[model samples]
Target: MSDSVLLLRRVRERSGEAAAAAASGGASSSPGPAPRRKRGRRRRFYPEHRVYRARSSFLDLSEEQVLRRYRLDKAAIAGLCRELGADLESLTGRSHALPVAVKVTSALTFLASGSFQTATRDSTGISQSAMSNCLAQFLEALQRRAARYIAFPAPGRPAPPAGTGAFPGVLGLLGSMHVALRAPSENEVAFRNARNFHSMNMQVVCDAAGAITNVVAKFPGSCPNAAVLENSALARLLEGARPEGAWLLGDRSYPLKTWLMTPILFPCGAAEERYNALHHQALAALRQTRALLKRRFRCLDAAGGCLQYAPQKVCQIFLACCVLHNIALRRRMPLEPPEGPEPDPEPELPLQAPHVQISSEARAVRARIVQQLEFTVQMSCESCAEAVREALRGAPGVRLLELRLEAQTVLVEAELAAERVRELLEASGRRAVLKGMGGAEDGEYKPGWGAPNWAGGEGGGQTGPGVPTCVPVASLGAAVAALSGPGGVRGLVRFLQVSPQRCLVDGAIDGLQPGPHGLHVHEFGDLSRSCDSCGDHFNPDGECHGGPEDEHRHAGDLGNVWADADGRAAFRMEDSRLKVWDIIGRSVVVDAGEDDLGRGSHPLSRVTGNSGPRLACGVVARAAGLFQNPKRVCSCDGLTLWDERDRAAAGPPPAPAPHL
Candidate 1:
């Protein structure tokens, strides 16, 4: 301690002597003003306030140096650095590349997270203020540089060299718009961005390969795809892409203009005609084709139609499908040789058979049948237009008029093509007008000149102005019954003669199952399957019963339908207690799995139906008076059965099944 103290004293004495020497040399030192005394008697200068500046750290250095020191991949860093350099050049005049990388990292982090301070600070280790500046610079650079990448490419052609024309690809143009909420004001407390933001409709043009070609974002109030297309960058891009004779496909939402676009028609387009004669012929052929398909395969569904073959990619899947369709047409279609017009057939058959005299009674019967046919045709025509007009009143910008000339009776037809239809419907902003015909065309008479009134003309000449028939939703059940059978039960009911004297329950499943699954009758036709539809329990008599084996069990509690090895469930119950006719608004549900009713410790798993998901649903119906109902309606038992199987051989039976 003595030596340390002596050394400290010597240093102090030297400091003091130096001060005195300085003062003597006119430095003006009076013991440095007694070293600044404190208010306390024994106070001295504070050691902490020694006036030393903090050293700067390399941690604030630019991104490139950090990458270099950190031994990052040179190429990746170089690429990123180049991007940063470009961004920096675009944003600011400074050419130094160091700050660009920092800005790049900052901007990416900011855009991705929507928080400039947090994302930039965390990613680039830059201060908050620096991060904000970098982000601003980055955004400005991006807008300028984006011009190179956003141009539209031509469809079905090769892209020119870099300095030449644009690229070629099949463009799949789709438009989607989003509405933004309004911003919060001084008077209102801020809730969410939705309340204050404006929405943007994005018209995105994608290639058949599903790559994005061009995107135009705007906020035009209530504009439809067609209207938007007319004004959008995508429209311009598309015009150039498919210069001449290129196909443009869209849903019915597009206007029916006779532009170069080929509007791929849906099933509804089957009715569209070319000319008067050809229209009828084409329609007949189409109808026959559809009938044959339904009778033979019954594979096509109204909704799925052709989408089953579409690719998994979401953006340009439609375009790809079009390409596939075109390819298949090229390879597999059978072309017919051109034909010349044939001479008209002779008015009379060439003496194939000699005329024979007929009884007066037979002649009278034939006359009666012809008279009935005439009545039916007349009634059908008068009712047709009203029905169609009712269907179209909700459609805006559509006008209708009856076409009639002296003695001729025919339905005049007019239509906007599918694309134009889409456009107009969008402009009107109403429910989309799917494939359908005009009011006058909705009726039943064939086109041609009408016979004189007393001669029994088919056109009933509107016995009076036709009364508009309002479709009653509740009458669906009775309607189905009339269409099928007398009692509303016979048409769908099958009397399967399991044995000659024993007629077990018969009838095949209708639309109950697409393929096959577990089908069954619940104890509660009431559909206490849930409380909503069917009333309470089928019995509600408070009968005590348990399990499928219980005889006293309520009607609403039938066990499983038990499928067969082929996954089809076919069973016949002589339970005279089960009434199929009264079961309207009730249904036969298909289950994906078997119902064990919580038996066994495995906890009775329901794989489908209540069992799991409801796959397909069909309601029971009885066609009352609508003759030749176009929609398929079933018998009381919900089967498409007929008595023709009585004398004729029955069709091959369904395969045996098992529970789902």
Candidate 2:
């Protein structure tokens, strides 16, 4: 203790001598009096307060680097700055205030990357505290001006890309997603969703082209989708006055309103199944919208991790991201390095576990759509459907046969073309138009379903074989006719007995003037005069020459074929009177003018519909149906079906044009 005390006293004495020398020298050198130091007090001094001016990150970084970090191009960012820069001014006299662009970039980095203060500070060279302030300011600005970007179009405004997704009158597609966030100090339990995370359930409505038309971000994750929709401004707007016939599409989680169409929970019929299938097809666009949203701004998805922000700030941030999304779309900015493949929608939405009865109005809307599917036919009830089934039964490649007499639309999933299906349906004195087509790619028709229990089997999980339907070859009664004529005219016609009362007449003729032609079958198979030798119409019963549909018309009055400017006439028709078996030994004739269908003023209209001079004719003969006739070389000419077809296509040498 004695030595240590002596050393401390010596050190203090040397420090006092040094301070006294400095004070004496300062007093002698300067004109001012030397300041006195209070006893027992230590002098405190600091290094100079640094003035760090944050340069604009946009200026220093390359465009690609900036877009990678900030998720917006230079022009888009500049446009955003012009939109919000005036609002971000600091009126205080701080000399080294942050530049507007630096603040914007800092805020954007946090928003796009969904990172914390540390991550944002590294990207924008701003301190953590500064970044927090910048983000708060940016979000506030977005919230105040969100109406300019995120909006629900007013009633009667051209619904953007309206009805393009094939769901008519669709104003928007409604969807909900859970956004992760820090648990709020208040109501933390409400924020924890079934996903086992604290998040806000955001309701978004998008048009067909993946543009956000409306967004609701205030609801907690625990709230049901229907409830959130109920409380949204969009609901109020729609309830007040929706456009005539307009509706919003939602998944089954949404309740059915007059203006909100949702899928049927337990679809019982083909119509309901198709409605859901088509509904899902339309929702695919909504999913694409979600894809683009999450891709451009990772903050909206789990890829960005949980946003470390308060619940209120989280809502503002969602709004802010939406604004940026729209701007990017408007600026035609593409996500260069897009996010990973899109996530499939949750098979079932959360918080909709509570069961509720479908209201009568909901049932009515469902029934209306099911009924509106399509058709005009003479028959009604299951009897008509049975008749249709009878026609398609034993038909080759017919996988799924759904006959809804009420809807009058028969859905047949088969390897056969839709045109063929229409022809088959039309055979029963009915008309069918194809509403949609699928399976354009190879193996697109998944048909493990040839034996159809129309209403369906126990589980709905079994889908068709996506590959070409592996169907056994089935047989039908068929006939074909080959036409030959002067002046390079050639043709082929096929007749198939689709049912007892219906026959499909499909054929093509080339080298005729670009106009209509009367097409009819004759009683005789002889084509000695090319067409004139084939006797009068094939009228088994004594009947007048009338249109195919007329009750007293001759059996041979099929109708007319209209040729294009290229002098090619391809035609398909269904005639109830012309049976393939009955017409197999007859001949077909083509006239020069349109058939008047026996209702014109001309004297010969009753007998021939005033059709002009005959040009080409062919003898009808029994032909191999699909999968029946083996391709044996003809014993006489050594020509297979394809070889004969090629010779017919080549036709006789073109007749020389008359000298002008």
Candidate 3:
């Protein structure tokens, strides 16, 4: 047993003494009854009992501070907490779950500022995982109650008639906006847009008061606006049956449907122009609603940066924000101020041809003119016209311009009396007779003088007093041929007279891409030069380009035809404006792109509806009828061989052969 052995024995005795003290719950020298062991329980620190808890800061916040930070008043916040607690009790499954107030505050803070989960947890005194849970639950609750906040007007309360208000009979205005998002890992190509950015196209329908009535948030950014609407449940509802006279107002991006009214692509008459103006005014509400929604929830704005969630979660968040927006509107909460300068406006689409330029000075001078006088002046030659112009130049308050010697007409912009100008012109040795003058008993322009009655009269298809009320039923057909290209596009377009004022157009075009294409009747039937010989849309009434249902649309405006995934299109529609008698021998042209129906932003929209180049064209010919003759050719040049024979045999026919 040397010194090493003694050291070992001392170590062992000390260890044994320490073990005995631990078993007794205290050192032997300081013993009391070992602390009584609790059975089947573990001790935990309750934050509620602490003098200062992690969530105490929320309680200390002032009412105004809470509202400013969370966009909810004290009353609203408490209500939300109560409702959420009741709804989430079963899911949470905790007799003493996290306080409802704490969960709501955390979720609201995250939603209001779009902060990360870490930041939200730090500020709200909840764990990051707990914060995520709270937010998801809260969003779910809001979505479940969305119907309570957002709804269409009741059927019993019909919207007012058109022209009665800012957006008469307009239940909602439809539009789409982009929402930024992280690139999805699966099917990433489907989420990328032309700009190479990942996003979702959120379509919203807002009422006249700027309240969002419907929202579709699942479409990928690559989806066109029109496609999104066509795929939506709302589209099915509208297609199946629309509310009587209730329609949605949209921009050119949307297709013109019986339940959805878009602006005229080209405004021809005052009535169509008025419709366009009112349509724009009504659609503006959608823009304002989007602005307000993004302003209220910075999380929804691009400025806040893209949301770092999966597409499914992103959709949920969007819907939750919409629910909150409707709630804010109901509660009359003060919205957050706009965050920064607005983005620059989109550039205007280029016009097809440059408009005639007018100098600013000329415009100003024209604005000051109180009256204009048009007169027929007898001037023998250019020398005489020069003398009359010089005489009028010296007259007081008389600016004579645009002298057409061939037509013997002179226009004078003046502030003086018309009689005085006539006297001055007559004094110059030229007999002047007033043809027209401004500020007369009649308005600016008399009926059928300035603007032609394109549709003849409101009751269409009645030619004259002795003419039949109904035009004879007729049918026309076209063998659609591809334009001079390699796309191999071909189809047939047929027109069948359904009634005097209505006709059915049926078309089947193949060898095209899957999407909308412009289908229309052109003014000319000559295909010798391909589609070039086909003039602009057949606007016999001198009307603007619009949808088939438009009151003042071009006779050839058939709107858009959609192609299936197989590059085949089949279209059938009834139009009151098109008649087989009118369109026979005309050309049916298919455009390369969707027709904007003349309401597009491009200047060419006025004339061409902004549809791209012709893809296919064919001459519309009388299929089989009294008017059908394969060899017969008639044009504005006058009747052919058959007309001469008819006149010779009948001694003046009862009525002329229907002019082509």
Candidate 4:
């Protein structure tokens, strides 16, 4: 008993001693819940002061090097930094923001080189994610300031410096270029272009000084230039504003409108030839401007590789590049060497029939300037005549100058003022007297010299004085059949001759896929073997297959029809080719694929317009009236099953039958 009590006392004392040691150690060392784990500081790749210093001293690079690397001079970079500083600070947060210069440099590197984000990160010394964020933010800032940097000159302003001998009053040059990109996951076919590259078609309008004034950067690369122009805000602006006496010079890829001018298709006379020459000279500015833009911003170069971004993002990048280009021009930065080949000519589309009219006073003014003038010069010898000829030959606006020594007279054809010609002759030390103004009396002007062929009479070959004022109405019924399936597409289409050159076509077809389908009028009305029996497009003029509005195209080319998701397509278009009186008994066919309007690189484009197989067929027939209402007729001849059922239920109207 004595030994057990002593052991228990020893154990109790040891336990108390152990508990005290544990509590003291826990309070001093273990602490409470790890002290809530302090967030670790991010390791700096470079010293913060160094980053700040790098940004602040960005202009330390020579102007040439900066222009070569970033397509911006030191002044431009500085201006951009100052302009974007506040916005950048707000986006990145003042406390942890990267220097404004760093963000701008990252964006400029990407734009100047058209390099990928990873490449940009390596050059910028920033993480790829940070660079990406920086690019997005920079683009946003540029877009906000775009209006300030890029703007068209106001109406009545002096024309920008067009190339040598450019057209007068040309406000800007309109053109488009392709920006290559990786194919999108959806609608990849829609973005595949003639070059077989996925891209975006960017439309740009630049002043003669090569400064971009406007940009529309969202059209799919496969879209035709004409279609893009026709569907752009620029078109609406030109249409509504109709900037007085100002014209946008463009290549044939654009249509001829009052506010937009294109080169004459087939120039007839000297005046027309001169106009065409000037138009081409003016349009050269656009081509050179595009080349310069791509040269300065290599990211836009096709050689830089397709941009790896979504379509919308790619558009933003394009617009941002345009803004920077304008800014660079403002800062007088020299352009770099072009990075790729010049863009190819755009595919042709249906030409829009020009609706502009030339005023009589304007025509007279043109005739007066562009005319043959005969003047009597007091020349004594052949040497004198030779001297006069040499002097007139070097004149700026002279088209042709002839000096006759025997008659002592001089004849000149030019776009020169009468007083300027007199002064030139007088300066040559020969007294000259004006004889005739325009090689003939004012009332005896030649057919093609007074006004543009389009302004006077029917020049497009489709419209003439002999053409009827009103085209008759016509209707066509289609029995559509899927190329590979048992189901069929069916619809009725009506055509009305709205004017001498325009025919309005309205129809609805069911059972088509929800995409673009080729629609055309076939040459034959035969339906013996369905659409296959119908010949090729109704090309009576022996013309190429093109859109209905094309200057030289098959009469049957009606272009494309887009179907809705519900497999129904309703279309109404005013076609300049389809005269209601011309296509009677011909067949209308709907095709399986989109129509390339005869401009596709594929061989089938020449014949079938690259539209797949015929999916539906119908015969054209004369209609009693335009848009004849088909729904007015009775569905059933005043009788119904319900009426019969009621009569039967009422015991067959026995009393009425007896009275009869």
Number of the top-ranking candidate, with TM-score as the measure: 2
- lDDT per model vs. reference: 0.32, 0.68, 0.65, 0.66
In model 3, what is the error at residue 43, expressed in angstroms?
14
- For each candidate in turn, the TM-score is 0.27, 0.52, 0.47, 0.49
Where is model 3 more than 4 Å wrong at Cα?
1-53, 56-60, 90-96, 154-157, 161-165, 338-660
Question: Which of the two candidates, 1 or 4, achieves a greater lDDT against the reference?
Answer: 4
Write candidate 4's Cα lDDT for 82-116 as tens digits. Answer: 99987776554654668789899889999888878
Per-residue alpha-carbon lDDT of candidate 1 for residues 1-660, written as tens digits (9 for 90 to 100):
699999999999999999998778774544434467567676666676454223222345454543323222234334545754755754455523235555655544443222326543755666667666775565455445444444455455542211101111113434232222222232222222121322223344433333334555443323444555678765565545553322332323343222212121211011111212232222232233222211211112111122121111111222222222222232432222212222121121111111222233322222111110000101124344343334434343222222122311222221222223222322322222121121101112222322112112112232235422221122221211100111111112221111111112222232232233333333233433332342333444454322334455443333455434433334433232233334444443334444444242343222112344433222334322112232222455454322222211111222221210
Model 2 error, position 295 (Å)? 2.4
lDDT of 2 by residue, 391-481 (tens): 7665654433355566555555433433455446655544443332221100111245432211221123233554222222232246778
- Give the TM-score (vs. native) of candidate 4: 0.49
The sequence of per-residue lDDT tens digits that candidate 3 reaches over residues 461-502 is 333444333221222311222233335677656554422344
In terms of lDDT, the poorest run of 10 residues in model 4 is 472-481
Q: Show where candidate 2 strays beyond 4 Å.
A: 1-56, 158-165, 338-347, 350-354, 373-660
Candidate 3 has a TM-score of 0.47
Q: How many clashing residue pairs appear in each of the predictions shown?
A: 48, 6, 4, 2
Evaluated against the true structure, the overall lDDT of model 2 is 0.68
Q: Per-residue lDDT for 276 in model 1?
A: 21
